[model samples]
Target: MDERISCILSSLKKAKLTPKFRESEIIQLENIRSATMEDISSVHSTSYISSREQVMAEEAVLGHLEHDELIKDW
Candidate 1:
């Protein structure tokens, strides 16, 4: 999780406002494994999953993508 997001979640917990948040707002907190492999497979094609996993593995070793150039336009 990103530090900013972690801080936000911590603040929410401290405020005791989580239950007041709607289901959609809290969906991002659902555990990554909440979905079964079969369920994920249903949504993602086999090749797409393989390619994304490969990219993630490579990023883990090489570090995150440099977004400075991309963000300049935005």
Candidate 2:
């Protein structure tokens, strides 16, 4: 995920879409707390998150299968 985010940032930089931030402005905080279920449920239902997870899992499996087919063709 970090690599993907870096790739996106690099692409944006190449396109001159993202403004360069100062080194001082880029703060990497440590030990950040994750949001609780109650906090998340305030905005989205647990069922909705579960459904989205299912969809993403299905898409990932389909993508893997497609990649495998392409490899076989090669």
Candidate 3:
């Protein structure tokens, strides 16, 4: 996922669409606490989260999951 984003960003740089996006590279938000169910609940309902998880899990094959939706249909 990171690689794909980086590739797109680099391509944008090559295209000169983003003048200093490469020079001003993105920095990861370090030392952030992992979100728990309670945190997620603040924004999403339990049923929706569960349904979303089931969909993602169902799509996982051989323990691998790709963000292919960005390029192809699910």
Q: Candidate 1: lDDT over CA atoms?
A: 0.60
lDDT of candidates 1 onward, in order: 0.60, 0.58, 0.63
Worst 10 residues of 3 by lDDT: 65-74
Give per-residue lDDT, candidate 3, residue 40.
95
lDDT for model 3 comes to: 0.63
Per-prediction RMSD in angstroms? Answer: 11.7, 10.1, 8.1
Model 1 agreement with the true structure over 1-74: per-residue lDDT tens digits: 33454587678667755645543454544555566778889999999778766766875677764434322222
TM-score of 1: 0.39
lDDT of residue 1 for candidate 2: 22
Question: Regarding lDDT, does 1 or 3 come out ahead?
Answer: 3
Worst-scoring 10-residue span by lDDT in model 1: 65-74
Best by lDDT: 3
The estimated TM-scores of all candidates read: 0.39, 0.37, 0.47
Candidate that would win on TM-score: 3
- Model 3, 2-74: lDDT tens digits are 4555598567767865534434654547889989888999999889889877766765744544665442321
Point out where model 3 deviates above 4 Å: 1-25, 66-74
